[model samples]
Target: MSRLATLIDEGNRPVVTAEFPSIDGGGLAAVEKAADELRPFVDAVNATDNPAAHAHASNTSIAIAMSQFGLEPIMQVVCRDKNRIAMQADIIGASLFGIQNIACLTGDDVTAGDEPEARRVFDLDSTQLVKVASGLAEGHYLSGRAIKQPPALFVGAVENPFAPPLDYRVMRALKKAEAGARFLQLQIGYYPERLENFVAGCVEHGVTRTTALIPTVVLTKSAKALSFMDESVPGISIPAEMIARVAGAGDKDAIAEESYQLTLELSRHALSLPGVSGIHLTDFRHDGSLERLVRDLRIGPAFAPDPVASASGTTSV
Candidate 1:
């Protein structure tokens, strides 16, 4: 089993995950940089494939690069760009290449990206994709054909905690869990109370015991980024105080430092919440920021030789 699968099975320590954009430029250089700078501080590096519909190197390709560099990668599979047949093929190929972690997403609308005229395939939504992936992992094809060798995968799905119709968020999570998602990566941060309430709701609905919750923490470099998230992002909620703090910062370095401090504080708060399986750090154009944060916090081992067997095992901040 992969290390991430073992961690989820043990459910003892929080798994630390970091994300990086698969930009067109830099190619292997970028992957090498992330491996050198972040591999020591993160349990897995999530290679985002054309997030927001922007074009970049394929996530699976980038994941292959990371693997070549001896780093674990959480390959993100977006449903907007491919049909079910292609999606299934990608899953089989990813597992064959030893990319065990997969994060299924319903992808942002094509209008939200640089190429608004691009065609979107949306053959399956995230839930259906999860079911397909689960079936593939169990030695059966989507067509009910038996596979000679099944892929061993750790499946994950994304959730938006602050999305409206609050109760529906937890319901969606339960639905994903029922679809065979072993872990959930939530789009959250900035509002601890909201996250706490989300977790409470999950517990009340009996979702916590079965599904692992890993909330996202974004490290914004400037007030403009926060403003964009607040204004353009549909489900994210950036507090007013955060905007004021960043806007009031006098210079560039100060703004970066302030943002870093805010992320650290928020991350610490997130770690304190109940039923939180891990924290996913989103690096918003902040080079090496995730590494610095992890090193300064002195959290548990970034890459454990083995998953902790019990709650008595070592903890990661």
Candidate 2:
């Protein structure tokens, strides 16, 4: 079986997805470094376009990560970055490079990514993208043309469980399911009860079969990040106390350690839960903090080997 298939077993194990930070041209290198740093614990890498500040997520750098790193890349194909034609081509191209997982997103607005002049093409939204991927998986292209080998991809979609109108969140997951979404990766929710209630609500809504539900952990101490997040990313809440704790830290290194420690706590908490499938690590500022958390946190036998040749690498992120 392929590595991704093995990572996503429906029964007992949980997978870990490491987020590729949007740190400009240096971001891909960071991802490469992280992949090498956390080889054993990271099952896949979630590639997100920093629609607010990144000009690089939609190009060859993504392809380079897929081909060179041997990392199972989750192509976060956001609609805001491409039209129908571009999205379709990207799906096909990623498939050719053995990228078997995709997360369909309508994408944050250009303003969110801080690129107001950037043209936003959310022409299809996420449901349509899922349908497009499903069609491609079934041996037919979106144009209905038969391809030589239809790429078989495991489609994943996002859900914001903490949104005010909870019904809409349920409906969104259902829509993605109808569009052939195999898994749902939820946006980070601050309260654990809120997270639990969100998943329980999904089960009650008759979408329980839509498995492989992954909860993400966002680690950062930057007040600027919190401000940007509050304005741009909906349903994400950062408490004042948390911010103050990070603010009191002496330096970036100290802040990253604090964030890493928090992430480890969150990871352990999530893994102990029954219905939770996995944890997605989203450390925005810290370079190697995610890797350090995975290393310090004890995992079961299912985790892959450590990516760092030895523990000699810096853990300060």
TM-score of each: 0.91, 0.81
Provide C-alpha RMSD values for all models, in order. Answer: 3.4, 6.5
Question: Which candidate leads in lDDT?
Answer: 1
Q: Global lDDT of each model?
A: 0.82, 0.69
lDDT of 2 at 165: 76
- Predicted structure 2: clash tally: 10
Per-residue CA lDDT of candidate 2, range 11-96, in tens? 43567776665535566576577566545557777776554445765633564474477766777888887788888888888777
TM-score of 2: 0.81
Model 2, poorest ten-residue lDDT window?
Answer: 300-309
lDDT of 1 by residue, 143-179 (tens): 9988878988888889888878776888999899999
- What stretches of model 2 exceed 4 Å from their correct place? 23-31, 57-60, 222-228, 231-234, 241-261, 285-288, 300-317
